[model samples]
Every structure is written in C-alpha cells, then in structure tokens.
Target: MAALADAEHRLGRGLPDDLRQLLLECDGIIGHTAVDTVWSVEQIVAQNLLFRTDSSFAQLYMSFDALLFFGDNGGGDQFAFVQTPQRPDIFVWEHETDSRRWVAGDLRDYLGRSLAEGGDAWYQ
Candidate 1:
C-alpha cells in the first residue's frame, strides 16, 4: 500500500482503488503465457516515464497526459490504465500497430475477463 501511495504521489494522481489493492496482493503476476508479467510499483513508474520520454511513442505521448503501465505480453504489447475522469479504463497498446484500444472498463472488470478467458491473449 505504501508503494502504491508512493507511485501515486510520484504520478501526481491517485490510482484506482482496485488496482492499488491488486498490487498489494501481488506485486506482479507471473507464470501466465498471455502476460509475461505485471510490473512492480517501481517498474510501473519507470516504464511510464520511459514511454513518456521516448519519441517513438509520440502518438501515445500526444494523446495521453499519463499512463500507468501494468503488464506486457512477451511480444512487446502493453497493458495499462488510461487516466480518465469517467473511469481509468484498461487499455491494450499493441506494439505492432502503435495503437491503444480500450479493453475493459476498470481493473475489476479486466481481471474478471482476463481470468474468464484463461489469459490476456483474449485481448490479442
């Protein structure tokens, strides 16, 4: 929980409650084929900053003020929370297309769906 707060403080925004709880339960998820790993708190901050600074992700940079990257498929596609007022929707950023698509309404929904589908490949 402290880690999550620290991350939110660094990010200058509060993360969704469900996400914070999930992180507390497990720093990250592993042993899943569809998702290589869910990032740790530090990794979330670092990856977000990396993407924010990289010119290659200019499309994402131009559109979103902040993105909380949580997971990645081994292939480079990423899963993240998009900062939005309505709800912080989970989005899948396809590396090949350099495009992001809303995949779930919130963290809880995303988890339910991901588990129902057996893995993150359902998004791909």
Candidate 2:
C-alpha cells in the first residue's frame, strides 16, 4: 500500500482500483516468455513519468497524457490504461505505428489473455 501511495503521489493521480488490488497481491506479473505483463509499482511511476514528460517522445509519438502505461510486450509495444476519462479497458500502444487500440475489458481479462498460450503479442 505504501508503494502504491508513493506511486500515486509521484504521478499526481490515483491508480485504477483493479490495478491497485493486483499490485497489492503481487508486485508484478511475469507472463508468457518471461515478460513483465504487469509492471511493478516503481516501474509504473517511472515509465508514465517518462512518457508524459520526455521531450523526445513528444516529437516521436502522440501525447501520452491520456495513457498510464503499466507493462510491455517484451518487444517495443506497451500496454496501458486510459486515464483521460479513466476507464477500465486496457489498450496496446504500438511503438512502431504509434497507434493505441483496445485489447482487454479490464485487468483480469488482460492477465488471462496475456498469460495464456500466445507469446508476448497475445493481444495482437
């Protein structure tokens, strides 16, 4: 709980309830091919901060202000929760195309699919 509190403070926003509950159970989830399907609290804070503030990212991709990144695909793609409207749905941010698309209904559904028999790009 302390970690989550610190993360929320650093990000200046509350995390999704489902993600907070999951992190309380486990720091992170290692999914197919040993990927960090769900990132630890520290990583979540750091990554989101980077994506939101990095000047290089601003030039390279679309604004990340609406996305709270939580994990990666072991490649370049990343998974995140939409923050602008604050929804439970998970979306995949394709690094190459800079496209964001819906992948799961919630954290539980995301874990079920990402950890199942489908390598790192399970959502694709």
Candidate 3:
C-alpha cells in the first residue's frame, strides 16, 4: 500500500490543472472501458480509477502497445496504459501520488504513446 501511495504522490506532482479539473468533473478516466457497472465513489479518487481490465477494447486495437504520461513533476500528475491484445504485456506512463490512479487516459493515447518515448507519440 505504501508503494501505491508513493506512486500516486509521484504522479500527482506531474498532473495538470486541466486533468485535475477533468478528474473533478468526470471522476477520472480509463484507458480501456468495459461493462455497464458504476464504480464506487471511493474508487474514483484523483489518483486512482477502476475500469474493466480485460474487455473488447483490447481486441479492437492491434496487439498491446505502449503509452506516455503528460502529468507534471509537481502536484498535477496523471497516468496512461496500453494493453496488448493477448493482453500479456502492459505499457505504462504515469505521474501521481496514489499508484491506484495510475491510469488516466484512453486506449488511443496509450497505444500511440507506447510506441514512442517520453510522450513522443503525442507528436505523431
């Protein structure tokens, strides 16, 4: 749990006001979405988000890819993740104080960034 907290702290420092606002507005986002279930309020913290781990989104995109983080080094951190089709591998890009909220983007961003280095894919 300490590790999770530390990771979240690290990520928060890098997040931006926009993300914070987004979080506050939408209660955080997910990389891969699956299911019609509502998440517990406790599960939607600014740092952590809970979404379906394995779903159809993975199958629509090419095999798992990588991701890039756009969070800050300060107190506005965020995260991103790209999962493989077979879903064996996961590429993560994150910045936050709660490791639980380490994933903050969608599959498109994750896959695009995962192929690049340090958020370079965003340029593509």
**Candidate 1: tens digits of C-alpha lDDT, residues 1-124:** 6888899888777776777887889887663664645677888877777777777667543544546778776678788887755366898888777688888888777766666646657676
| Candidate 3 lDDT over residue span 15-88, tens digit each | 33333334445532332222111121233222232122335534443222233232222222333332222222
User: What is the lDDT ranking, best to worst?
Assistant: 2, 1, 3
> How good is model 3 by TM-score?
0.22
Best-fitting candidate, scored by lDDT = 2
Cα-based TM-score, every candidate: 0.78, 0.97, 0.22
Please give the distance, in angstroms, between residue 49's alpha carbon in candidate 2 and its true position after superposition: 0.6
Stretches of candidate 2 off by over 4 Å are none
Look at candidate 2 and give me any clashing residue pairs.
none
Off by over 4 Å in 3: 1-14, 30-124
lDDT by residue for model 2 (1-124), tens: 7989999999999999999999999999888788999999999999999998999999999999999999999898999999999999999999999999999999989989998885887788
Clashing pairs in 1: none
Provide the clashing-pair count of each candidate structure. 0, 0, 32
Ranking by TM-score: 2, 1, 3
